[model samples]
Target: MPKADAESPQAPVDPRLLRYASASRGFFVAIAAIALAQTVVIVAFAWLLTRAITSAIDGMPVAELAPTLGWLAAVVAVRAALLWAREAVAARAAARVQTQLRSALVAAVGALGPEWLAARGSASLAITAGRGLDALEAYFGRYLPQLVQTVVATPLILVVMWWQDWISGLTVLLTLPLIPVFMVLIGLATRSVQQRQWQTLQHLASRFADTVQGLSTLKVFGRQHRAAASVERVTDQYRRETMRVLRVSFLSGFTLEFLASISVAIVAVSIGFRLIDGALTLAVGLFVLLLAPEAYLPLRQVGVQFHAAAEGVAATEDVFAVLDAARASKGSAAGSADSHSPVPEPHPAVPELVEGRLVVRDLRVHRGGGMLPPLSFSARPGTVTLLEGPSGAGKSSVFAALRGAAAFDGTAELGGADVRALAPSQWLAWAGQQPGLLAGTIAGNVTLGDPAPDTAAVSRALDLACAQALDPALELGVQGAGLSGGQAQRVAVARAIYRHLRGLAPVVALDEPSSALDAQTEARLWRGIRSLADEGATVLLISHRTSARAIADTVVHLEPSEVPA
Candidate 1:
């Protein structure tokens, strides 16, 4: 297990935040315009209210009220239109940012490679890529623009209030700091809650994913009830954590709302006293009273939305954690290898040519808290080396070491160059006992990441693997679900053979490649392996079964340790 480093730099701030902040420029401007429009609407409505009240007091004609009422209604209509536009623009901006974020995340994960992925389980990744990112919708679509509006519009509203009446304006301005101060305190408290919530979510997701993946195994072993109990325990913990977060969230919102309400009431009382003293006109006093709540409305909304969005920000931090881990050493390793020597040119197309000259001298593997013996072996071009050993004699460990699956001691050399020093994309292909088949047509899986293979090449490889009976055009189903074990192995062989034909690499290491096959099918598989060697590729086969030994140019045997008697 890898140890966490305390001194290591914390994961960088989420790229989504940066992307959102940048993309939200238009959204912020739109919101500012809407707020300004709303202010005009509020002032107009106040004017109309004052006009009617003063007119009633002075005994003005009732017919004269029509124009003022019409103007107030128009202001409301225009404000409604601006609000619609603002929402539309903000939504568009949010969507654009989300797309960019998802793309960046996918690219970052791709760069991390299988080793980092192995350390971080697929369930955690699924959460990050799936529901984890969904959390950001609120952060981007709602909270972000409101945050910007609060920063810009709050000051402007305060300034307008001061212009109309300094006392009420100063009251709002003085008490305004209390809202955010209280918010900051609550935010600090909620941070820990958010972190715990996110952790629980990851645990739950991982447990659920693992359970589903192992459902078949549990049923076969008569352990479905045990699996359900495990899931129930995890879900119960998740429930407890969720309740904790919600409790804190409700408390934060209640506190902020109570404080904001008090501030608004203080402003209202001050305005009312000024009106009673005749220091302020009725129109101005009512306007100030109405604008007090409007001014703080965005900030108040932010407090509530902030609690909802904290989970998203916390999850975003985890997403960045995965991306940072993936890209960590990729640059230095790739750069150092590239700077050392120019890559060799590809060999000309030939039916068969010996290229791989693998040399393993003093190779050692450390795994499961034990160090295996120093392993030394060689597989020359056009030779199949059958590696045979007892169940725990490290035969598969040798395959892993050759293919760079785990870190090891000593040197593995390919054509006189250290294998560790070789770029991973160079010189090796590995197939395990259970070959991994993604969901796709057989031809697509066979080609893997290569450019789509032509019809002829696909046909030839399938025919060679004795999978001609399997349609290349048919979908393989999830994990090759529709195929038998032997069929899957044969397709895997076809994939390796396809890569070999493409000249992508010169060596192949297979761990129990024919383990699931019967005698005849195993024979056909070994015949294909021999043909690969005959075609100038170095082949390393790991299996305990003796039948696979026939095609090997050499057989290396490993013995388990016991007291020598």
Candidate 2:
């Protein structure tokens, strides 16, 4: 978790955040209006208090100053009320914008889909969306409102101070520039510190995720100790970086306060001299003295809160970068060969397709800056089709293209109609080589993303995929920890099988489904695959195993395309 240090120096707030704040314009307007009102009350309170004090010094009766004192009390009350309202409005605005920004980011990520997001690790993206956006709370609640006060109240108080005593006002004016100058000097250091801290935080999160995901593999290879050492090193680095940020924040805050206090002391001293010489009235001198500190207060707060909002600003930058990349990819894909291919007719809202004939004719897929050779295959309903290729043979690329994740040239059709025309979710039941187990119940992973999951169908699918060892109601830890690799793979198979059994999709596809299974479990899994094919569904499976080829009704072998030397 990122700590919010109120006194830390921060970088300038992004204008993009300001534009995002436009959504809560009314709340900010209320905040500004309330701040302006508070400024007026501050002036009145200072003037009244000075007058009451001055009257007493002039030997006026306490009773005679009662009404002036009463008005002073009333002004104090109004200022307090304005303060509360200003805080409330700022908090509300922060909550509103945080919600808006986070939702927009999540929606954009979903629109980009798994392929793009996978390229950028899920752990980093999760941190950006979760803790990153959460950091904005300080930006909105404290820093932003204080920013408004610095712009509105400080200047107004300064103007009142000027009207009361020009010399004191001139002194404040000359010294006022020092606060921001010192703030800027500190902010340069703060910005670099914050950037490093944020980067370290992201690195730590990514490393932890990677270590956890590969812990099994590490254990198998007798490298778990090495992985733990790496994790500890990363954790230590993060701790050091965090401490550095805190140190800088405290130092910057002390400097801002020292400068502000010095400026106030100078004003107080000058006013005292003027009063001893009888060059200034007691009321005016006292009023200027009181307002002097108030003039610098807002700027001081801004400098401090800037550091608190630093992490949020960095996180926002990362999220927008992801969204921008997604948009650029979509724009690029829109002009690619996939977009030019004939689009299939829109399927009905409810997926009612029970069976589909699969066809891939002269299909060339683009992936990772390379193109797969043109490939063709066909499978009738109630048949299992296998795609065979060695490593780097583009079998996975073909799967990605058929799944509509990769852009392609040529045609992929279902039942003589272009597969692109069919609703992707409605026509395809996909289980990738990676299990893709989420953090939830076994049943939940099995029925994931299904609009309406049926209990009987879920149970039957689980049984068919031979994942009965996992209790449907039992909660699984992150990434399905505690489950063996075969169990996880079977869980994914159950998910795909459930979708088809529920008639949500007609074409069931599995990528290397038997990779983790032993011969016995692999045989059972193949039976499930054959059963699905027998039930009038077109089945597509990718494999390099001879055993997989034995069960296939149709085999399509893709040779690695030659790259010229």
Candidate 3:
């Protein structure tokens, strides 16, 4: 994954987000239609209002000017309505884009798996996918539409100005370049500042989230104060960073507004000179002045909104970088031909291994700066196998390798074919060292992502994992917070068992399955686990406890491998 760095302020628009934006073409099309109608109304309103006012100044009778006044009123009313419709369209587009981008971001992160997510820090990812994407609302709703307006409206108004009087048009043309030049200079200077602000935001979010998640542990160890102090420090830093971004924002907005106001002033001065010399009529001078500000308005709004959108842009860059990393890692693992495919098909299934033994021959996993000594073992059908090892022995590494969560060298076979060649969905059900439960009902955790979760199967798995003690309807806090350690582990085990019971997979792997259980609960859990083996499913457990050996059909003891100099 890409490490946090000061991203270039001038980084190009992310193609991923652009692709998502493109998918909402209908929304933009509606917006464009409205903008076009609104632009025409604005120009007409200016011309009609000018004509009526000039006639009034010339002492035209009220009765005679009534028709012109009525036309102006009608134009103003249509312009107001179109303006409302344009805003409504922009809001709808913003919402659609935000929802689509957030969903895609989350799905991509999930497909990358736990190992990749952990490396990036979950809190940071959460904030990016949640709040960071939300910032795009300002971009989509305000900045982007105005940008389109500047493209469409500015030129149309400028042509009208030039047609009215060549002198006023010449003055506007000379000053128009100044607004963009100032905007560009200010953007270049503040891009890095905004990038840094976003990085600090992610860091603060990561620290705060980790602290909250581990609050109980910190309180038990009487270090909560220290954690609080650290949080406060980070929070202060974030505040300062936020202020810096605000300062830049205020500066940019002021600069763009000031430049635009001066440009309008210059146009006003030329129009006034022409009017005094009788070279221009009162109506024409007033029309040119009104249109002058309109021409610069869109460009000025773009500059202002661009600063607001900078943080979202930075977050977007980070999200795409993570996605790119995931793609690269997957590509490397699958090799060239099937590399880009997220999931490749296993080699044609061997019928003999379809429901047979899992065999390993010198299966060495590369991890922690060294290779684990070649492991040779066989897990027969209808047997429970325990992998016993000291801390740092690469036991979990080996387990992950067999499950295809990590890459390894040497052969691992089921029946007679290599394990890597077998479809993992056909055989593997894994419960990690910690219970990875979302905040939901116990039943929901047991059947996460199951299309049609069966209550009977859930109850059976709960009983088998000794987790029936937990009420099926009980709600767990985030990360299974409300449950005790043992209960949480049991719930995780139940999840694997639920999958097994549902016939999704036949082999179950539990990492430190009973580490939090008391002797009695541990025994009951293992007995339940062992029963699976007796019922013709392969069971693999990783543990360091000596008591686990008593129930295991085979115990393989491994010592930590030494790192080579």
Per-residue CA lDDT of candidate 2, range 1-565, in tens? Answer: 2333434553455555555446567766787888788788888888898898889889999899999989988998888888888777777777787788777778777667555664666777788888988897787777778888888998888777888788998999999999998888888888787877887788888999888878888999999999899989988988998899899999999999999999999999998998899999888888899899899999999999988987887787776666566677566656664566364434555334465467788888776676667888888778899988777787877778766677778998876667655546767899998798889899999999877879999898988898876799888887887688889999999999999888777888889888988899888878878987898878889976778876799998866553211
Model 1 / residue 281 / CA error / Å: 2.0
Q: Comparing candidate 1 with candidate 2, which one achieves the higher lDDT?
A: 2
- Please name the candidate that would achieve the greatest lDDT relative to the true structure: 2
Residue 69 error for model 3, in Å? 2.0
Superposition TM-score, candidate 1 onto the true structure: 0.83
For model 3, what is the error of residue 489's alpha carbon versus the real structure, in angstroms, after optimal superposition?
1.4
Q: What is the C-alpha RMSD of each candidate to the true structure, in Å?
A: 4.8, 4.0, 3.1
How well does each candidate superpose onto the true structure, as a TM-score? 0.83, 0.90, 0.91
Report every candidate's CA lDDT: 0.73, 0.81, 0.79
Question: Sorted by TM-score, highest first, which candidate order results?
Answer: 3, 2, 1
Candidate 3, residue 379: the lDDT equals 88
Candidate 1 residue pairs in clash (backbone atoms < 3 Å): none
| lDDT sort, best first | 2, 3, 1
Runs of candidate 2 exceeding 4 Å displacement: 1-13, 18-22, 325-356, 407-410, 415-423, 468-470, 560-565
Clashes of each: 0, 3, 0
